[model samples]
Target: MADELKLLSTWFSPFGSRVKLALHLKGLSYEYVEEEDLMNKSQLLLESNPVHKKVPVLFHRGKALCESMVIVDYIEEAFADAGPPLLPSDPYERAVARFWVAFIETKLVEPWFKMLDGTRARAEMADGVKQMLAAVATLEGALAQCAKGRPFFGGDGVGYVDVALGGLLVWVRASEVLLGGVKFIDAARTPLLAAWADRLAALDAAKAALPDFGRVIKHAMMRRGAAAAALAQSN
Candidate 1:
């Protein structure tokens, strides 16, 4: 425990998934502690991330690291020589990747999560889905430019932006079924993203890191139900 790295996570969270992806890509071995229930917070979690009290808290060498992206960032820097570099060597390219990562969070991630948490009304939720698709369309363009005929956003191999968004692939796929087959990463509209999703999914790190599709869908459905009930009561 003193010398080893530990990750506190829930099985179905994309935030946790991304951190796991980064760790796996780096070939890092970590102890994963599954938090079965968020409502009943674990002592380790509370101590690890008191400010956010959220999952995806990573403990390295007896110290705690909070937030998923922050943890990913830390993993990349701390374990730079452990595996392939997630960010590019050039500062400009790294900046570009970081920008896209920000876009993924503000545009795609926020909207998708708003719908997931049932924080919005029915009409608002529909609008949220629209926002998500719009972000996907934007990322489609970003991918074409960034990839330059390569297979990934980072080119050839998985890069920072790829790990950032790739973590959400399972949820994105689940959202299609949740939306009655509405395609967020449409082959027709966002062909790059559609293909990117497939390639990223096929990666060994992705397979090891990502939550199971069926289980994610089931867990999300239950969360949606709870959120809907709460929203209905509030309304």
Candidate 2:
């Protein structure tokens, strides 16, 4: 019997987007339950992820799995025979993939959040942007090493690191718009990485999994407005 699968996610969450991308890459058909308000989460979400109470929780065969990356790994393992492999078969390659995924989750994302919240002064925010760009440069180098002239990090296919970083493109693009057209990834600064991002965006799975660009921009604008208001009030 086929296992019943359900994914609890929120539309704007890049973390949740990772899980969606993994599922699509695996060609897994599952119910997507959107949580409208995270503060007032659904009972199902609460019950499914009592510890984190977070979205991107995967329920397979009546067991709940929390954390976006963890859920993605689980999907890759459980559906190993169902679709293209997310992780490379070679242990060394798999370890390298996991390393970059960890770098993306731990090193890159927090600085991005700080930049997004806009709580820092002008100099601090500039430094934050520099930090983010440095992280991108590191990723670009890693991709260049692994891509080996292929379009993706996984050599003609999207793999673990691809899903890990690809999901954040929306937010990164939105942040550029929010910052009055400050370019983060572009042909001039990050040509290879920028091209890779474009390729990822154009993929059918990405088009299906990612939220609309307009929606992301609008949400980002709202957050920027709120941040600006808060900054004004503080002065």
Candidate 3:
């Protein structure tokens, strides 16, 4: 089974890394395929995820699953017999984990993209800053609720919720620099989120899945510059 799994991913994608970590945690040996060219996507990735045409597609026994969290959930279901169990059996617990994942994807990541687009347009920049601050505050509140005296989302052990949130930390922080100095997850301000990040980073699987923060930040800055140049050219 180890030789059969294949992962299609990009190095800097938080979404892609989440799927990678889940497969690793399940002790599944997969062929890692990095797709660096987004403009010229791989034929396999296109056919596998025609709707999204994105990275982090998982192929297990020739069946393809798209989307990071969905693929991770699929991996958990298929490889339930191996490694630490990521999702909770309890229905309520599973719901809660899914809720947080949704929150992060919608409220957290979406606003950052807005903040990125805000760079060239004065109106967008103003709105983006406002939205980003509000988004960060909401995350701080959610973190406070989840912290309930435990290190992870599952109280003691790392679970699906933790993995979902934890996977985005490296990319989020790297993106802050590109958003022109918006520090959303500051250790000094959002202490609980900061602590959670530290705890997650200490885990072996987290460290293995993460790319160097410095390189991610540099790549983000370059992406921002390219976007800005394109916008200018259009104007």
Q: Global lDDT of each model?
A: 0.83, 0.80, 0.73
**Candidate 3 RMSD computed on C-alpha atoms after optimal superposition onto the true structure:** 4.0
Off by over 4 Å in 1: 1-3, 227-235
Candidate 2 regions exceeding 4 Å error are 1-3, 119-124, 225-235
Best by lDDT: 1
**Model 3 segments beyond 4 Å from truth?**
118-120, 225-235
Better lDDT candidate (1, 3): 1
lDDT of 1 by residue, 39-69 (tens): 7778987887888788788889888998778
Instruction: Supply the global lDDT for candidate 1.
Output: 0.83
- Give a tens-digit lDDT track for model 3, residues 1-235: 8688998887767777788778767778889898767767779878988887877788889988887888878888888898888877899878877888788777766655565663457676667667766776776777666657788776677778777777777867776776667777788878877888888888888887877799877766667655332222110
* Cα RMSD (angstroms) for every candidate in the order listed: 3.7, 4.3, 4.0
Residue 52, candidate 1: alpha-carbon lDDT? 75
Listed per model in order, the count of residue pairs whose N, CA or C atoms clash below 3 Å is: 0, 0, 0
State which candidate, 1 or 3, has the greater TM-score.
1
What CA RMSD would candidate 1 show? 3.7
